[model samples]
Target: MIKNNNIDNIGGMEFATFRLKEGVTETRLVELSHQVEAEFLSQQEELILHFLVRGTDGVYADVAIASSQEKAEEYCQQWLRNKVALEYLELLDKESVNMTFWSKIN
Candidate 1:
């Protein structure tokens, strides 16, 4: 779930953290991430870069950079409802989910 939804005037970045669900492998997550990129993220006009990262503690992070804060917020809200996005989300431990958006500063 989203932890903060604060908006800023500049472009922003999305930092979403979660743990993989039981039986979910990193390979599978990576494969599905590609699908989400193709079908969902790539469609966003202001999206700059979207990538997945894993921590030593097993927590995973989904990082997305957008050209504008408004577009970032818009994409985040819309992605939650996208079928491909939902499929990717299913790999994560639901209770571990936390998303925060950070706006770029001068």
Candidate 2:
């Protein structure tokens, strides 16, 4: 199993924006989204980040995920390595453990 001591076990959301390649269609985007989701599900609960396909630019995708930052980055990189051409990628921000709404409001 994958293990990272620095990984934040606290569940939260991660937002990422990507630029697509040229001439990529909406139908293809949906298919790609599902593929990415399937890849993510393989990680089990440790990678329980919900992915949302925000939009597509040509052949790129603006995707977002809600999960641990470490896992998210790892997954995203793996995705790029295997899937679409990653023009650029970044970790927008990470919510601290106590910052999670589930924990904050409790």
Candidate 3:
């Protein structure tokens, strides 16, 4: 579904981004982060790199490097549904949430 043909190293890299809801506590985010790290990244064999980053203005980044584009997006959406639910994630635009990937490039 994610067309990565023109991107570099599409086979081994993926990226996701979002914005956190207002009034979301740091402690809550930490707890969710721990749960995600333990349950998904640690348990899922297909995911080699997975991280959630929060930037200024509540911007968030959900990055992953997996075996394929579908796997990468599937993993991200699964995590979001199980962890943050659908209501909290804010999309700036349809395109900004698009993921970018990279690999060893050998």
Candidate 4:
């Protein structure tokens, strides 16, 4: 877990960066993200914010901020098993995945 006072209004954060599989377009990614949000994330009451961001290096990050560190960890575990989340993960390159959880101190 990350501990830094510079961060504020955050209890915990999940940061996952990866590259999409070959031939997967951003349009399909966004469409699947909506499904993940509705079917998985929305069910987590502790989830504060969630979004997908892209970098110039052709990598994308799936970010989720939660109300607590435990909730953040829980979400990460659940994400791996959730049907919609699994479907979403299918678009990403498995070997390129890097996921971590951080705890804020502020």
Assess each prediction's global lDDT (C-alpha) against the native.
Answer: 0.82, 0.42, 0.58, 0.85
lDDT of 1 by residue, 1-106 (tens): 2222333323788899999999999999999999988888877767777889999889999988787666777898997799988988899999999988887886
Question: What local lDDT score does residue 42 receive in model 2, on the 0 to 100 scale?
Answer: 54
- Across 1-106, the per-residue lDDT of candidate 4 in tens digits comes to 1122234546888899999999999999999999888878888877888899999788999998887788889988997899989989999999999999888876
Ranking by lDDT: 4, 1, 3, 2
Better of 1 and 2 by TM-score: 1
Deviating ranges (above 4 Å) for candidate 3:
1-10, 80-106
* Collision pairs in model 2: 13-66, 14-65, 14-66, 19-60, 20-59, 20-60, 21-59, 21-60
Candidate 3 lDDT over residue span 1-106, tens digit each: 2222344434565665655455666556566666656655676666666566778866667667776766766666675665433333432333446566555455
Name model 4 segments beyond 4 Å from true. Answer: 1-9
Model 2, C-alpha of 23: deviation from truth (Å)? 1.2
lDDT, candidate 2, 1-106, per-residue tens = 2332333554434454444344545566566556555554455455544444454432232433325555555554565565432312222112211111221111
Worst ten in a row by lDDT for model 2: 96-105
Model 2, runs deviating above 4 Å: 1-12, 53-67, 81-106
Candidate rank order under TM-score: 4, 1, 3, 2
Question: What value does the lDDT take at residue 49 in candidate 4?
Answer: 83
TM-score of each: 0.86, 0.46, 0.58, 0.88
Model 1 CA lDDT for position 30? 97
